[model samples]
Target chain A: MSLPGCYPLHDAIIAEKLTKYYGDFLAVDHISFQVRKSEIYGFLGPNGAGKTTTVRMLCGLTRISEGKAYIYGYDINRELVAIKKLIGVVQDISNLYMELSCYDNLMFCAEMYGVPRHQRKERVMDLLRFFGLEDKKHVKFKELSKGLKRRLAIAAALVHKPKLLFLDEPTIGLDVKSKRQIWNLICKLNEKGITIFLTTHNIYEAFRLCDRIAIINRGKIIAEGTPTELRKKVSGNKIIELQVSPPIKKSTILDNVDGIIDVNIGRDNTIYITINDAIAALEGILEIVKKLSLEIVMLNLRGADAEDVFIRLIDGTEKNIGSSTRR
Target chain B: MIDMLRLEDIIKAFYIAKKDIKEYYLKPPTISWGIVFPVAFTLAFILKGGHHAQEIIPGLIALALFFGTTSMAAASIVFERKIGSFERLLLFPVSYIGIALGKTLSSFMFGMVSLFATLVVVLPFILNIPTYSLFLVAVLILSALMFSAFGVFISFLIKDPTNTMMIFNSIRLPMIFLCGIFIPISSLPLPLRLIAFLLPLTYSVEATRFAINGNYDVVPPIESILLMLIITILLILLTSIKIRRTIP
Candidate 1:
């Protein structure tokens, strides 16, 4: 199945220093990465962090200003037809024809990708059933709910049975249940041997779905590794959870306590602190609480998570990139 | 590169055309712009001119086709861009030329259908002579092709839907008076006549006048058809180039 290319046959996507510029603004810096076959590779970044631009470049929706990219051993620029046949992209918006019925929408996609006429109907129906949208097949896309619209968009992308699926913010604005369902669907798609390239700002979604994650900021990829590897490499902060009877500001113990990286106030008077050395920071935190006459209702030590990693990275570059990049 | 001349690409173009007709031309906005706008303009001309309606009928029908093809065609693509659906079309395995042809084909079909539907009502009142059916059909097809390609070009150049309509109307509104749609081209001022000669619609209107009334005074029908075909090819080429700039 190798398409006569220099890139490894096992690699589904290989982007080498791909760049994009919008007028004078550098939207994507010299970025490079690879996605192996059937693995869910996540590009985790905040808004305007160039994740979407990178995906667009790789998909040939936007031209790469410099360098090269290959999809299943086909060059993105020279072999766009071959690359397009190998890929499907679910954009940020579920942008199927609003006037067409769900069944018609998928059928139109099947036609666009040149799915064989005899097999198109059956493929569309199978996708509808898989997405739990068979009952809404006859309904116009505009009449469907946001969740259904998103689901149909994904189904439409799969009509031609793409090998590498690009999902840009797959579950951006969804309820907890709908998001979880989409997460499960993503897992199912990956299990079906479809290589997934996911871009998201959601920490939990990235942690839950991605096999390996790349953290990007200011148009540059800062770090990339597996969930466990990311935690071990750059996500080395210790998390301390303390619920005080009297609520205190996040900055109240900043100067008084050393080794504390960042602090966030959670629900129910609980405070989550990301620190370098938990032993020294915890003693300093206890003394500060005693001096302030605030009772510690509950105190527990927790392992570092995606949030701690994100805050650690954001805080590390706060001086270089002015204003908080966290959203 | 995918060849636009390939059979597979042509089939894909037809697929895109079918989708566009079903997804855009059947909508309320398209129906209103494609048929009602031209009919209203025709009605106004008929009411104002009274007995002179016979002389202006051919031009009016040509004018209707001009507006019918351009207005909704531009609106459909620009609206797709606004809703982010047009980008989806670009992601498909179709060439830029194929995409332009598909959009032009859709608009051409809509223009022809809408014009004939309007003609059914108007022709009953004006049917007194043996009409040149085949020649008229040929003239209609060329005019539709020119306008449809022009509209597709406009869609590729302008990104916003409202702004596209504004630009189309700004050009189309003035064309009605300039292209001899209601007035006689021979009697127009020298400067205006020169301007009219520069417009593609002028030849189309003149050819329609010949096909409907057996008059070839302003311009010859053969020459008019030749000019229309040239303009259609040019517009489609320009549209494909303009749309390609979106990628790089």
Candidate 2:
């Protein structure tokens, strides 16, 4: 399917070869992508993959070493002030003032964003209620539980009702329940017409929440697509595992079988087979086993997921969409 | 839009200052370092002898202001930077000068508070110590502002809290010796006198001495005041530059 326009008119973010270098070391190699309006764009990468570096550049917290980026048509380098007004950032760590209570933290953020005094109280109260932090409004940020602290951090970022929100690992260290609550909050925020740029390493989080995901490795983007689209990158292959009384001594027995991609005989008399058409090849596989007089004990077939694609891309087994490897 | 931006900068700066004052300036450790230590040190001088006790008051006040402003500013900024909150401040729409000014003003106010506490503790005990109130207030304000700027400058230059405190102590302790705080600059050797001339605290102490005694032991009081003002402006400029380059 083709996008409607040459340039995405509804894009909230656009980067043109955005790059960053620390002295001689390149932290973010030239990488470019777009985030559409009102969509949750997930930025996934391994450690030291420049995911945080890219987000920091877009938010104007770090200077770009080369190339340029624009947030809602405002150049990040030249019009940072204008861009800052339209965006809110929740860093990986809770950056709220620990000494201040939850209410004061929100009020302070409101003040920073220049929310009028008359509306500041209402804005803060609304955020407290929205994040379900109203009961802990008077509690100091340091005294709040890890879950509450994360909630208050997100609440603080929303004090100004930013058009775009940059969330860096919002639910990184939260309990399962807390993580689910934040996911719901993120969904609710997006429902109200806010675009979200999220950077996370949690595959499930990205898979469940992001409208689109871009996987980056070693400062370069290796793949960009929806979760299902990425899964399809390796969908041509299927995994079939079989247990037999005696493992086949010659792995070449299935080499000539139609639709069989590869076969690996493992310890404990287990046979692993990769095939193109599992339904068509199942008979051939069983025929070989019967001829060898191997008793079939167990069998299982599995499909690929986002985690598999991620591993393949990062491990250099899958070629990048555009062959972006640098010499 | 420009007017609103300026207004927002001012408001954000105020919020940062308020938060810092509550979080750092009013804390027990800062209060003790700024107030209690200076009072105790000054009292030790008073108890030792009444002959030169009046002369030591200005030095004590200067000492309190120096430690009060520098320690609080350095500790606050280093702590914020270490915990990653300072980077969040950079994401706000405020300019670098606004952030520097906000921190400087809060530290300055804390310095003034410490100066006030020192005076309240010592003034009633001293007799016949002539005080020119106008010049005294001028000297106090200028010294606090200049030292606050110095504190902010040093904080921006160093990242670790321990290293900042060490540098501050090394610079301030040596300055106390060279600035004629405890002894007359004229009585020092020529080489030491040149060193005293290079120190900003020298002018602050001299101007303060003139404010209390109606005469300066070194250069004229007016010259010292003007020099202190010039140094304050320069320090503010240096602080702004450091913040701009180092923050992002």
In model 2 chain A, which range of ten residues has the least summed lDDT? A318-327
Candidate 1 chain A: worst-modelled 10 consecutive residues by lDDT: A318-327
* Candidate 2 local distance difference test against the native: 0.81
In candidate 1, what are the lDDT values of residues A1-327, reduced to their tens digit? Answer: 435555678989888898888889999999899899999999998899998999898888898898888888887878887788889999999899988999999999999899999999999999999999999989999999888888899998899999999999988888888888889999999999999999999977898899999988889888898888877754455667788877876556656688777676664556767677888899899888888899989888766567656655645542211112123
Docking class of 1: medium
TM-score of model number 2: 0.91
Distance from true location, Cα of A82 in model 2, Å = 1.7
After superposing candidate 2, which stretches have Cα over 4 Å from the reference? Answer: A1-8, A241-258, A262-273, A292-298, A318-327, B1-7, B26-28
DockQ score for candidate 1: 0.73
Which residue pairs in candidate 2 have backbone atoms (N, alpha carbon, C) closer than 3 angstroms, thus clashing? Answer: none
Candidate 2 on A83-110: residue-level lDDT in tens? 8889999999998887888998888888
TM-score versus the correct structure, for each prediction: 0.91, 0.91
Clashes of each: 0, 0
